[model samples]
Every structure is written in structure tokens, then in C-alpha cells.
Target: MELLSFGDTGWGDELFKATFMTILVALVAFFFGFLISIFIVPLKLSNKKLLNYLGNTYTTIFRGVPELLVIYLLFFGGSSAVMFVAKIFGYKEFIEINAFLTGSISIGLISGAYTTEVLRGAIESINKGQFEGAKSLGLKKTTYYVFVIAPQVLRLSIPNLSNVWQLTLKDTALISVTGLVEIMRQSYIASGVTRNPLLFYSFAAFLYLILTTISLKYFNQLEKKYNHQP
Candidate 1:
């Protein structure tokens, strides 16, 4: 009865809610970052030097910096930057970004950095002869990539990119420092208020482990399915 109590007494509701929010944040971040990676990967693979340089710079700066620093910089500067742009468009009234948006973008940016590398590696792994054949067959670059590179790249990178997703999911806990109601934040509060650090933190650990295990199983199944395909 005590363990199942709502809100303050048992931490049952708070833990569940925070866990859900954490998963939500990770999902949103992964989606946006994955989209960004698609563009970055191809541009980096382009023959043009400028595009390569730009993509390299993006990956370098994001990946080289600590994630906590990245989160802090984005959380503090991102809102101001948004409002600055809004002001130029003449619609500024102190635009605010809630912690969720801040966490999502910050994590997304970091995830994009790693995802770009994974995508680039996958793209490079494809046979260069295939690309030449596509060109020789009069397929446009867009068509070649759409019909040729994208499918193979997705298949090749699923294992590596699944690792990236796991990294991103765990890193979401860092966003607790920004005051998001993630599992870590909730556990911190519960430990302090209830003066039961062991109990609350243990619960948090188990919840995170459960989430990761479930995600790993799905990724493995996906990998198996793709692997068995022609």
C-alpha cells in the first residue's frame, strides 16, 4: 500500500511520469537529429570541398565538446538567440523556451553529431562501383541515392545507429540538471525530501535498466530482420 501510494508518499507516480517524459524527450531528439544526419551525411560525402568542410565542422564542434557543456550552452543561449531572430522579424516579446524544448534540441544536436558519423560510414561502406553503374545507367544523383544508397545505408548502419540511440537515451538523464522532470531529477528530489537516497536512486536505476533492456531487444529484432533480407 505504501509503495503504491500516489505522489509524495511512494514516488510511484512521479517516477512513472518522469520516466515517460525522459523517453519522450529521447524520441523527439532522436527523430530530429536523425533527419539532420541524413543531410549532413550526404553533404560530407559530396565531392565539393566546401560542403565537406561545413559538415566536418558541425560534427567536430558538437562531438568534441562535453555534452553537459553543450546542454548548458544551448539552454542559456538558445532562448536568447531565438528571441533575437524573432526581434529581427519584429515579433519579439521575450520568447521563452521551456526545459523540454531546450533538452530536446540540445540532445538532438549532440545525437546528430554521432549520427552523422554513423551515416557517413554506412554510406562509404557501399561499393563505389554501384554508384558508377547508377550514373552510367543514366540515373540522376537524387534517384540513385533514393533507390540505391538510402536503403543499403539504413541496413548497414542499423547496428551502429542503435548504439547511438542507446547513448542518446542515457544522456537524456543529464538534462535533469536543467530542471526537466526526467527520472534523474525526480529521483534527486525524492531522495532529498524523503531522506531516502538508497531507495529512490535504486528505483531510478532499475527503471533506466528496464527501459534500456526493452529498447535493446527491439533493436536486435530489427537488426535480425534487416540482416535476413536480400
Candidate 2:
């Protein structure tokens, strides 16, 4: 209707832009979260007690805390924390972090903890004898992991990673608190402007459903292909 019609007269354009922001934030968070998992999983599985403890403590803290609180902390406290560190390195100034970057980093940290657990479990589930066999072939450490273990771990991880992706996608809604004009934030603004919460909110929900459904379908196809491969 008029409320959702395109251009300045309606919220349609803003909603579309917000949707794009949602996808971008989710992508940023998921990728960085996976990167974090790569390092954290190794630490979790490391022989050193201190490294293992560090990983455990990280996972325990991030997993134990609410994602919203993490974003709030990062949004409000992150700049100060950054400035504090900068001061230690002979710099004295307020370093501002924009909402998008802050939201992405905060959600990425939360997603990373869950990803670490999933990846660690996947890595541990692999047969230990494979590592010895790879070593016997004289493969370098990176080559051994890439050639021998990464594929198996990835296959084992797809389902859990899919779930994490869902979680991360949904969690992007919470980043509205940081003033990023993603779906939920746009919905709030439109609802407030038009005084028609139901329509805008319902549309917001539908947008989320579309994103999740498409992502789930993609993951399903990926999982199936991985399973069917020789």
C-alpha cells in the first residue's frame, strides 16, 4: 500500500537498503567468526595447558554472556578500550568506531565462540591415525591440514556451521541497538513514523524468513553435495 510504496513517499527503499545492510553485517560477522574459530580451535586443541585454558576461558565467557550485552559493551566501551591501548603505544586520542564495524566485531566475537566449539568438536572427531599417516608422508604442517584434514572437518562442520549461520543472521537484528539501520531498526523507524507497527513488523519478519530460508537451502545443497562426493 501507500506505506510500502517505493521512493520517498514510502519506506520501501529504506527497507531494501536495511536488508542489504543486514546481509553485509551477517557476512562480515560470519567470516570473521570463522577466522576466529580457526585460531581458537587450534588453541583449544593445543598441547599447552595455558593455550587450552585461554581458549576455554574465551569460549566460556562469550558463550555465557548475552549477545546484546556484548554489542552494548563494544559499542559503548570499545572506543575507550581502543583508546586505552593506543595510549599505551604512545598515542592519546579518542578513536571512534562506527556502528557497523562495532556491531560486526561484537557479533563476530559471539559467533566465533560458538564456531570454535563446533570446529573443535569437528577436528577432534577426525581419526587420530590420519595425522600420523599424513606426517609419515612428509607433508608440511599447513599442507597436511589442507590436503588431509580440512575437507573432512569441513564436511563434519557444515550442519553445525549452518546453525551458527542462522544464529548469526538472526543476531544481526540485535545490532539495531547500535543504530545501524538494518531490518529491525528500519522496521522500528517505519512503524514509529507511520504508527502501523503490525504491517512493518510483519514485513520485517518476512524479510528475515526469506533470508534464512534461502541460506538454509544453500547450506542444504552444500551439505548434500559434500555427502554425495566421492
Best by lDDT: 2
- TM-score of each model, paired residue for residue: 0.94, 0.95
For model 1, residues 138-176, the per-residue Cα lDDT tens digits are 999999999988898898999998999998999899999
Report lDDT per candidate.
0.91, 0.94
Q: Which candidate's TM-score is highest?
A: 2
Runs in model 1 deviating more than 4 A are 1-8
TM-score of 2: 0.95
Candidate 1 — worst ten consecutive residues by lDDT sum?
1-10
Report the C-alpha lDDT of model 2 over 51-97, residue by residue, as the tens digit. Answer: 99999999999999999999999999999998999999999977998
